[model samples]
Target: MSEAAKELNDIKRLMMLLLLKLGASPDEIALALQVDASLIRKTIPSRKVKKIVSEKG
Candidate 1:
């Protein structure tokens, strides 16, 4: 992929992480972003999810 596209994807992933930290579900994020939940779930690292969940819990 092009550098610009990669950067955009990285930005999107960061947004997904922030949304997740704020308690947004993957489905909600996907709907809002007009993308698939699987993509959102895939883009965010598993460790990040665990950390967010632990911090929120």
Candidate 2:
């Protein structure tokens, strides 16, 4: 990918992490970003998800 696209994707991932920390559901995040929820689930690290789930739970 081009540098700009890579940067944008990195920014998206960071936003995804922040949203997860804020307790936004995967589906909600996908909807907000106009992408599929499964894409988010697949892209995000399980460690991050576990951390958020543990913190929220």
Candidate 3:
């Protein structure tokens, strides 16, 4: 991927984690990010997701 494309991809994943941290559900996150929920699930493990949520909570 191009540099910008790679960064955008990284940022999207980060946004997913951030949204999850803010108490957004996977469904909500998928809708907000315009991605499939399955895509969201594939991008990051549930364990890390929970850790981010817990850290922010």
Candidate 4:
């Protein structure tokens, strides 16, 4: 990938981690980070998704 794309991916990963830690939804974190929610969702792991969902449930 190009440098910019790599950077964007890295930022998305960080945003996903931060969102999980902060208990924020993907849409909320995407809006705060000014990126796409699909990107955040794609970067997050299934285990992480389960954890987040379990916490909210």
Q: Rate the local accuracy (lDDT) of all candidates.
A: 0.78, 0.80, 0.74, 0.71
Query: Per-residue alpha-carbon lDDT of model 2 for 1-53, expressed as tens digits?
Result: 89999999999898888888767778998898899989988988535563444
The CA lDDT at 39 in model 4 is 70
Task: Give the least accurate 10-residue stretch of model 3, judged by summed lDDT.
Answer: 48-57
lDDT of each residue in 1-57, candidate 3, tens digit only: 899999998898788787777667777878876878887777765556554345442
How far off is residue 4 in model 4, in Å?
12
TM-score of every model?
0.68, 0.75, 0.71, 0.50
TM-score of 3: 0.71
Candidate 4 residue lDDT tens string, 5-57: 99997886776786676677778877987989887677784345534344543
After superposition, the stretches of candidate 1 with alpha carbons farther than 4 Å from their true spots are 45-57
Q: Which consecutive 10 residues in model 2 have the weakest lDDT in total?
A: 48-57
Model 1 steric clash pairs: none
Stronger candidate by TM-score (3 vs 4): 3
| Separate clash counts for every candidate | 0, 0, 0, 0
- When sorted by lDDT, best at the front, the candidate numbers are 2, 1, 3, 4
Best by lDDT: 2
Model 1: per-residue Cα lDDT over 4-54, one tens digit each: 999998887888888888677889998998988888787875446644445
Candidate 4 lDDT score relative to the true structure: 0.71
- lDDT score, candidate 1, position 2: 100
Clashing pairs in 3: none
